[model samples]
Target: MRSSRSWRLVVEAFPLLILCIGCGPASTASPTAKPATTASTAAAVASVEPDVPVAQPEPIAEPVDSPSAVIEPVAPQPVFRPDDPREPQDDAQLAELGIRVYESRRLKLYTDIDSDAARTLPGYVDQLYDALEAYFGPLPPDRNGTDFQMTGYLLKDERLFREAGLIPLDLPPINHGRHRANEFWMREQLYDYYRRHLLFHEVTHCFMTFVPDTQTPVWYLEGMAEHFGTHRIQADGRLSFGVMPTSPDEAAGWGRVTLIREAFADGHPRTLADVFALQPADFLMNDAYGWSWSACHFLATHPRYRERFEQLGRDGRGPRFIRRLTELFEPDGRDLATEWALYVVNLQYGYDCGRAAIDFQRGSTLTAETPARTVMIEPTRGWQSTQVLLEQGQEYTITATGEITLADEPKPWVSGPRGISIRYAEGHPLGQLLACLRAEEATAAETMLRILPIGEGRTFAAPITGTLYLRINDSWSELADNRGEFSVTITRAD
Candidate 1:
């Protein structure tokens, strides 16, 4: 989520020339006033002025050559510093207002929820700090070299926080979460997993503020935050960030995977460029978050782009960050788009990034000297190239011989070329062979691989001239348990 107010540093020397948008007047109303509903409160908060003093016009000086030179007194310049320390709230007064304070190494959390999760949020935030440090490098200490720390409010009841004077009147109202500088605020979430998820997401924003000069694109800012926020706590209480959740049970209330799948099914799938072009306003909807996360996740995890993607973290804080990013992947731009399309279309819980990484290879046209070509198809991987280009309107014959283990759970289930019917995926029997023709220069929008089930043997006419790519019909999430390979041959039928 984007911050409600954009943080800016006002130069005292040029106060009259600088104009700060979205700056409001400080509130004089009593905090004890009856609290408004969430929506109404957000509207009120958005209009309230921040505590910063308003800029005043400078006085003009009389000409030095005049007989009686006079200079008017200059108005005091309004200075704005985002890092200025907030007024300390008395713990005793906070306790009286039913606000519980929890502190750890990096986080000082205040919440009204009496649940154990709320009590443990500070520690969880500390773990999230470590994770961020690991990913983005350690944040520099303050000018005085003091260790960095953050303050957050997890609001179970907004009224309690408001009454305690913890919720700033100038804070922009948010639907779920918001962050500024080293502080953040979040409303109570229904699920513990999602609660932590949001906490981590807001903390990511806080961390990014420490990085200087970053005009990072909205897609990346939100996407990387969503990437890190999508995490799993291990049995040992260790927090793991950027995890591919194996099931909905592990990531309850997180619908990123579901959102992507639904979009693809609805024929509204976003391409890599589409995701990159997302504006801050687009993020008000949930679908923007899903697409953003997918793009970041794919680039960050894919073997082909991981190194370059990581480099982006270090150098992605400038105005030219997006242009640099585009240039960095310019060489593989086509492949990037094609692969991204495949990734979203096959996205699911427990997606196997390594196994599903496609290796695009150009194919040669068949000739009289070589009428047929054979290739080995692995069930453990996705869409292996057959290296045989097909011409439009030409008929081809395909045959396969294979026996593979689809699973080993209850009992090892073995299947031949014509996959077992007991289990199915993509409306076809699991372990069955599937084929699709992809044009040499197909784009994400044009790269939807239509499934052609060619179990043991089949003869079919090519709908379009393109390279043949094959894979075993199975769940994109369940490829790990697959074993063995199929020896397949493709021949140009005369």
Candidate 2:
């Protein structure tokens, strides 16, 4: 079952910035107040203003920059034959035209567009934002809301894309970055999605200002946008998205799948307090997007999301969101985990009581069986510091002992197996460590694992919510020195 993970509650190391280009927005231009589902590109442009920091990927490999984290470009250079499908349009000279469109529509959006395809931005904004606000709710008046704008650096040359680690589109994947006044690269096709999702997502950042500090869970914010990504223009012209996701389509990107996978993997509820404690760094953009999106989706898309959102809105944040939902299922209403279990069941199965816009998935419990074996670890060699890989939605414990070791004194040796590791502070990064923990290992567990803790197992919860993709450090501690042979177990955490 898809646990109810709240975006506001999760520790968002950094915001994700992705624009799939095809689907992910709500727009209605050509006329009228134009359903929130639609807006005049000119109106949307006028409505958009300012900017903010925001949002992923590799095959789960490769390095990515978060709001503050940056990695050098990957190898196996990428080449786009001047005429790739994502080539920028030739409309650079029309920034003023875009300005004119913004002026005409009264929309609050970016005024400086640098693409060769300029004048059309107004129309795009109108239709794009109109559609977006319709599905997610109106953009907030300021940063408190989700309204946002950015200086789009349309990439026409391969050098531009390469600079952002966007080349080798085949080598895992890398997403660009954005902040209030900083720069972000975008493919021509990306504009299509950005003008829709990323743009609105930034706008959502604005809406967040209105969110009561107490009610702002990391899960709701991202999940709502991600959940809305599946929206489509219905025959009646109304926006709609009701039906369990089926493969990949234009309306939703592969991002949808990633969200579900994370929610199922991250299988429980996390507190906003814990999330707030994380370093304010953009480490895992993909995880942020997937995790936040799932967190929100698990709440709003659920049968009880509306009630919870309403209660929290009425009460103005605090414990209402959690308390209200807990009351909905249990008598005492304390088992937040059970509430999450309920959410997983609802999402995994989805609901269609006949309203509109209801989309969820099957809970992981339905698919996952109990682990045959479970135990804690101090993993070593071809492994990482924290490699907690249990079936999604299952529980397990981590145990370790002082354990025995074979000492080989002050002799310089590099053959056989020498457990290598790097230690980092609280604000340190797993991505950075993963890049360094390589000595003839591949599988994540093998490439970077830690072992021989000074004492017992590092007791912790399985990462069963948000983006489950994580890497541990190549660190370890012996009774005294650094060279020794040790063994630990990774069985079920029963």
Q: Pick the TM-score winner.
A: 1
Task: State in Å the error of residue 145, model 2.
Answer: 18
TM-score of each: 0.82, 0.36
Worst 10-residue lDDT window for candidate 2 reads 430-439
Which structure among the candidates has the greatest lDDT? 1
Off by over 4 Å in 2: 1-195, 209-217, 228-230, 235-246, 262-285, 311-336, 342-494
**Cα lDDT computed for each candidate against the true fold:** 0.73, 0.33
Residue-wise C-alpha lDDT for candidate 2, range 62-84, written one tens digit per residue: 56658676776666432211111
Worst 10 residues of 1 by lDDT: 6-15
Clashing pairs in 1: 24-49, 25-49, 214-317
- lDDT value, residue 104 of candidate 2: 19
